[model samples]
Target chain A: MNPKNHTPLIFTLLGGLILLFIVSPLLGMFLATTPAQLFETSKDPEVVKSIWLTLWVSFAATMIFAIGAIPLSYFLARTKFRFKGIINGIVDLPIVIPHSAAGIAILGFVSRDSVLGKIGSSLGLNFVGHPAGIAIAMAFVSIPFLINAARDGFENVPVRLEKAALNLGASPIRVFFTISLPLAWKNVLSGLIMMFARGLSEFGAVIIIAYHPMITPILIFERFGAFGLKYARPVSVVFIVVCLVFFVLLRSLAKERKSHDA
Target chain B: MMLKLNNISIKLGDFQLKNIDLELERGDYYVLLGKSGVGKTVLLEIIAGLIKLDSGKIILNNIDITHEKIQKRKVGIVFQDYSVFPHLSVKQNIAYPLKGKKLTHQQIESLIHEYAELTNITHLLNRGTQKLSGGELQRVALARMLVTKPECLLLDEPLASLDVQLKGDLRNLLRKINQKGTTILHVTHDYEEAIALSNKVAVMHDGEIIQKGFTKEVFQKPANEFVANFTGIKNFFFAEFSPINIARINGKIEIHVSNHDQIKNGKIIIRGEEIIISENHIDSSATNNFKGKIIQIIPYFSNFELIVDIGIEISVVISEDSLFKFKFKENSEAWVSFKSSAIKIIP
Candidate 1:
C-alpha cells in the first residue's frame, strides 16, 4: 500500500478518539436510562416545569438583551476611538472568568444595598429568588457571545456599500436598515442562538442568584444531591434529548434560510 | 457653472489636500487624471459629501451646500469596487434608492426597467448579484446610481478594474450617459481613458491639481516637467536660449527651436515619434540634424525604440519596416533629424 493511503487512516484513528470522548458520556446515560424512566421523568410536574422555565427564561434573556447588544456591537465594529480596545476587553471579561465568580459579581451588583437594588426596590422588583434574577444572571454571562459574533459580522460588511447607499439618497438610518443589517443578519442570528444555548446550560450563576426559580440545571444538581445517581440520571437523559432536538432544529432552520437566501 | 469646489481643503492623518479649486459647466465630462495615492478618490468622496472638508465651500447649481448632508446633496458616486448589495437581487439593488420617494409601484417598476435597460443589464434584473460578471456588476452599479437622477455623477476609477473589451464597452456607455445631459467628474490614472472620455482634464500630483485645461491643449502644452512627463512626452532637456532661436543643452549640443522672444532660459520637449532616424544623412528641410550612434534598442509595443547618442541620448521610435531597412543594431551609426516646430519650449 502507498504510504499516503496510511496517512488518512492514521488521521481518522486520532480524530476518532476525541469524537468518542464527547459522545461516550451521552450515549452511556441514554443507554443506562430505560425509555420508561425517561418518559416518567418527562411526565413529572417538577421536571416539566423546570425545563419549561429554563427554556423560556433563557430565550427571553437573549431576546431582551439583544436589543442593547446589537447596537453596541455595530458601534464597536465601525468606530475608532481612544480606549476602544479596553472596552472590547471588558466585553470579553465574563467569558474568561469562572462562572461562579460571575454569579458572585452579579449578586453583589443587585444585592438590595447597591444602587440598582434600591432602584429595583422602588420599582417593586426583587432580584433574589425570582425569574427576573435568573434571566439577569443568564444574560450577564452569555451576552459576550452575541456581541463578539455581531461585531465580526458588522466588520465584514463593506463600508463602501453603505456609502453607495448614502450617495443614492438613502438616509443613514435607512442605509443601516436596508444594507448593513440585512447583510449582517446571519451572523447576528448565529450569535443569538449561541447566547440562548449558553444561557440554557448555565448552572453556577443562576443557582447563586435565584435558587428557588428551579431551572433544570439547578434541579438536576438538587436531585443528585438528594436521591443520588438513579434519580439524576433520568432527568439528565431527558434534558439532553430536549437540548439536542432544539439545537438540531435551530441549526437546520438557519441552514434552510441560508440556502433560500442563496 | 453646474458645480464648483472653491479652495477645498481636508486633512486625514498624514495626508492633506490643500486649496483645491475646480469648476464644471453643465453637461461637461471632466477627468481628474493622477497616479495612485495622489488623493483623487479623497477629492471625489469630498465632492459627493461622503467626506467633510476641513475648510472649503461647495456650490452646486448656484446654491451653497458646503455643509449639507449626503442624502440631500443630490450628488451620486459609483465606487471603483462597484459595491452592489450582495443580499439583494439585481432589480432590488437598483430599486433600493427608490423606496422612500413616495412613487407608485408601477412608477418605480418602470423607472427601474428604464435605467436597467439603459445600462444594458435588463436581462439580469431577477438574478442575484453574487455571480454577475465584472462588467455586469459595473452596469448594475451605474443603473443603481442613475435611477435616482442626481444632479452630478462622480466616478472613482470606473474603468480601472475592467478588462480591455469591457473597458471599451463601458467607455461607450459613459459617453452616451454624458451626452444625455449629466455632469460627470471622473477620476482615473490612465491617460488613455482621459483622452478617450473627457473634454476637460486635470492632472493631480501629491494632493494638488497641478494643471487643468481643455484635453487637447493640456496634452499638447503641459505646464511643467512633471505634467509633461506624465502626459507621455519622452524627451526633455533643460536648455538656455539666445536671441537667435538656438538653444544649448547641457553646454554640449545646440538645437534649433521655434522663436520665443521672451523665453531666454527654459526646458524643451521633443516627442519621440517626431524624430526621424536613418543610416545616412538625407537631404530634407528639417532645421536640426545630428549624426549619432544607436546605443540601445527596446521593443515598444509594435514599434522599436532606439536611444541614439550624438552629444546627448535622444530616444527615437521607428516602425518595424524602418528597423529592418536600416538594419539598426547596437553601436551602429545613424542620423536623427527633426523640424524646429517639433520642439516645445516651456519656461
Candidate 2:
C-alpha cells in the first residue's frame, strides 16, 4: 500500500475513538436494561407526564421567546452600537455561568417578593412551582443559543443586498423580511433547533423554578436520588430515546429544506 | 429632472468631502470620475440618500430631498458587486419593489416580464440569483432597479466587475436607458468608461470636486496639474515665459505659448494624442516641430505610444497603421509637430 493510505487509516482510528466515546455510554445503558423495564417505565404515568412536560415546555419556550430574541439578534448582527462588545458578551453570559447560579439568579427575580413576582401576584399568577416558571427557566437558559446563531446568520447577509433593496424603493422593514431573513433562514432554523434542544435538556434552572411539574431531567434526578439507579436508568433510557428521535426528525427536516433550496 | 448639490460636505474616516458644488441638467449622463478611495462611491451614496450628509442641500426637480428617507427618494443605485438577493428568483427579485404600490398582481407581473426582457434576463427569471452567472446577476440587478422607474439612477462602478465584452454591452444598455430621459449619475475610476458614457464629468480628489464641466472641456483643458496627469496628459515640461508668446522649455526648445495670462514660470501640458508624428520636416502653421529618436514603443488598445526623446521625453499616441507607415521602433528617428493652441499652459 502507498504510504498515504496509512494517513486515512490513522485518522479513521483516531476519529472512531471519539465516535465510540459518544456512543458507548448510551449503548451500554440501553443493552443493560431489559425491554420489560423500559416498557414499565414508559407505562408509569408520572414518567410519561414528566417527559411530555419537558417536550411541551421546551417547544413553547422556543416558539414564544423567538419572536423577541430573533429581532434582538438581528439588531446585534447589523449594527455596532456603543457598548456593542459588552452587549454581545452579555448575550453569551448564560452559557458560561454555572447553571445552578443561573437558577439562583432566576429564583431571586421571579420569587414571590421580586418585582416580577409582585406583578404576577397582582395578575393572580405565580412563577413559583408552576409550568409558567418552568417555561421561563428553560427559555432563559436556552435563548442565547438562538440569539447567537441567528446573529451569525444575520451577519452573513450581505449589506449590499439590503442597500439594493432600499435603492429599489423598498422600505427598510420590507428589506429585512424579504431579503435578509430569507437569505439567513438556514442559520435561523439551526438556532431555533438548538434553542429547542437546549431548553429540553435544562435541569438545574427548571428544578429551581418549579419542582412539582417535574420536567424529565428533574424526574431523573429525583428517581436516582430517592430510588437509586435501577429505577432512574430505565427512565433515562426512554427519555434519551425520545429526544434522539425528535432531534433526528427535526435535523432531517432541516436537511430536506436545505437540499430543496439548493 | 435637473439636480443640484450645493455646499455638500462630510467627513468620513480618513476621507472628507469639502464644499462640493455640482449641477446636472435634466437627461444628462454625468460621470463622477475619481481614483479608488477618493469618495466617489460616497458621493453617489449621498446623492442616493444612502449616506446622510453633515451639511448640504440636495434639490431634485425643484424638491428638496436633503433629509428624505431612502425609500421615498426617487433614485435607484446599481452597486459595484451587483448585490442581487440570492434567495429570490430573478422575477421575484425584480418584483419586490412593486409590492406596496397600487398596481395589481398582473401589472406587477407584466412589468417584471418587460424589464426581464429588456435586460436580457427573461430566461433566468425562474432561477435563484445564486445560480446565475456574474453577467446574469448584473442584468438581474439592473432590471430590478429599472422596474421601479426611478427618476434619477446612480451607478457605482457598474462595469468594473464585468469582462470587456460584457462591459461594452452594459455600456450600450446604459446609453439606451439614458436616452429615455432619466438623469443618471455614474461613478467610475476608469476614465475610458467615464469618457465613453458621460456628457458631463466631475473629477474628485481626496473627497473634493477638483473639476466639473462638459466632458470635452475638462479633458481638453484640465484645470490643474492633477487633472492633466489623471486625464493622461503625459507630456509635461518646466518652462519660463518671456514677453509676448515666447516660452523656453528645459533651456533647449523654445515654442510659442498661447493664452498666457500672468506669472512667468509654470508647467506646460501637451496631450499625447494632439502630437502629430511625421517622417521628415514639413512646413505648417504649427508652432513647434522637433526631430527626435523613439525611446520606447508601448502598444496600447488600438494605438501605440511612442515615447520620443525631444530634449525631454514626450509621449505621442498614434495608430498602429501609422506605426507601420513610419516603421517606428526603438532608436527610430521621427519628426513631431504640435500647435501652440494644443499646448495648454497651466499657471
Candidate 3:
C-alpha cells in the first residue's frame, strides 16, 4: 500500500467507534427483549391499538401535508422573489424550535377559545385533546424534513427541462405536475418517508398535544413510569421493529420507483 | 417577415445585450454565430419568450409577441443538453405537447410515429430517455419540438455536444426540418457550422450584434476585425492608409488598397485562401506582391498552410498540387500576391 493510504489509521478507528456508538444501543435493546415478552406486549390491546394509531396517524399527517408542502417546495425552488430567505427561514423554524415548545405553540392556536378551535367545534371536530391534535403536532414538528428535501430535489432538476415543457405548449400548471413533480418524485417520496418516520418517532410534541389517546412513545413512557423497565422494554422493541420494517419497505419502494422511472 | 426582433435589449446577470435587431423571412435558416458567453443563447431565449426582455418588440408573422407567454408564443426551443424528459418514454415525451389539444389517441400516436420516423428515432420509441446516446437524445428532442408544429424553431447549440459525424447528420436533419417550412434560428460558435447550415448569419460579440447579413457576404466582407477573425480570416495588419489608397503596413510593407475614404492607421484583414503564391515574380493584375522567405509549413487537411515572413508573418494557403509544383519549404523564398478587392478595412 502507498504511504498516503497508511497515514489515516487513527481517523478510521475513531469513525468506527462513532458508528459502533450508534449501533450498539439499538442492538443491545433488541437483544434484551425476550420473544415471549415481545409476544405478550404485542397481544396487549392497549399497546397494539396505540402502535396502530401511531403508524396510521403519522402516515395520515404526512400524506395530508404533502399536498401543500410539495407545491410550496417547487415554488421555492423555481422562483426568485423578495424575502425568499425569510420564507426559507420560516419553513425551517419548526425544526429548530424545541418540540415541546412547538407543541405548546400549536396548542395556543388550536385551543377551545381560539379561532381554529371554534371553527373545528362548529364543524363537530376538536383539535385539542384529540388524535387530530396528535397528528397536527407530529406534522408540525416533522414537515421541515419534507419541505427541505423536496426543495433540494427540485433544485437538482434542470430548469431547461421545465422550459422544454413550456416550449412544447404545456401550460405552467401542466408543466409543474407533469415535468417538475415527476422529475422530483423520488426526492418527494423520500421526503414523505422521512416525514412519516419522523412523525412516528415524535414524543415531546405528540405527548404534550394529546396525552389521553396515547401514541407508542407516550405508551412507552406511561408503561415505564407506572410499571417498570421490563414492561416498557418489549413495547419499545416491538415499536422499533415495526418502524424498521416500514422504513425499509418505503425505502425499497422508492428505489424501485426510481429505477422504473429511469 | 416571419420573425423580427426590433431593438431588443436585455441585461442578464453580468452579460448585457444592447440594441440587437434582426429579421428573418419565411423559411429562412438564420444562424447566430459567436464565441461563448456572447449572449447568443440569451437572445434565443428572449425570442422564444423564455427570458424577459428589458426593451424590445418581437413581431412574428406581423403579430407582436414580445409580452406573450412562452407556451402561447407558438415557438419551440431545443436545448444543448437535449432536455429530453427522463421520467417519460420517448413516445410519451413526443406526445406531451398534444395531450390537452383535444387530439384523439390514435391521432397522437400517429403524430408521434410520424415525427419519430422523421427524426430517425422510430426504433427508440419505447426506450427510456436515460438509456439514449447523445445523438439519439438530440433526435428525440428534435422530434418532441417538431411534433408541436410551432411557427418558428430556436435551437441553442443543439449539435454542440455531439461528435463530428453526429453533427453532420444533425446538420442534414436540420436542413430537412427547415425544408419542411419551419424557420430556424440556430446559435453556435462555430464558423464552419454557420457557413454550412445557414443562408443568413449574425455575429455577436460582447453582447452586441457586430454584423448581420447573408452568410456568403458576411464571410467575404466582415464588417469589423472581430467578424473577420471570427469568420476564420487569419491575415491582419494595423496599417496606415493614405488618401490615394496606398496602405503602409507595420511601418515597412506598403500595399495599395481600393478604398481609402477614411482616416489612416486602422486595422485591415485578408483571408489566407485569397493570397496567391509563386516561385518567381510574374506580371499579374493583383495590387500587392511581396517576396518573403517561408518560415513554417503546416499541413492543413488537403492543403498546406505556409507562414511567410513578409516583414510581418502572413499566412498563405496553397493546394497540394501547387505545393508540389512550387517545391517551397522552410526558408525558401516565394512571391505572394493578393488583389486590392480582397483587402477589407475594419470600419
Best by TM-score: 3
Off by over 4 Å in 2: A1-23, A43-45, A111-125, A259-262, B131-133, B240-264, B279-283, B290-313, B318-334
Q: Write the per-residue lDDT of candidate 2 for residues B1-347, one digit (tens) a residue.
A: 37899899999887789998989898899999889999989888998888899999999889999999888888888888888877778888898889899999999999999988888888888888777877788898889989989888888899888887788888888898899887899999888887789999999999899999999999988898898878767888777887547678888878777854855898888889989988798899897899999999998656899999888899999999999987887997989999998887888
A best-first ranking of the candidates according to their DockQ comes to 3, 2, 1
lDDT of 2 at B37: 92
DockQ scores for all the models shown?
0.73, 0.75, 0.81
lDDT of 2 by residue, A74-176 (tens): 9999998799999999999989888878889999999989999999999998999988888899988999999999999999999878888887888888888
Give the per-residue lDDT of model 1 (tens digit) for B1-347. 99999999999998989899999999999999999899999999998888989999999999999888888899889999999999999999999999999999999999999999899999999999999998999999999999989899999999998887889889999999999998899999988788899999999999999999899899888988899988767789998887559989999999999866668898999988899998889889898999999999987435788999989999998998889887999999999999999999888
Alpha-carbon DockQ of candidate 3 = 0.81
Q: By TM-score, is 1 or 3 better?
A: 3
Q: Find the 10 residues in a row with the least total lDDT in model 3 chain B.
A: B258-267
The CA lDDT at B327 in model 3 is 93
- Name the DockQ score for candidate 1: 0.73
lDDT of 3 by residue, A128-232 (tens): 778889889999999999999999999999998898899899998999999988888889999999999999999988877799799999999999999988888
lDDT of 1 by residue, A1-262 (tens): 7889999889999999989999999898889999899889999999999999999999999999999999999999999999999999999998999999999999998879988888988999888888888999999999999999999999999998998888888988899889888888889889999999999999999899999979999999999999998999999988878887888888888888889889
Compare candidates 1 and 3 on DockQ and give the better one.
3
- What order do candidates take by lDDT, descending? 1, 3, 2
- Top-scoring candidate (DockQ): 3
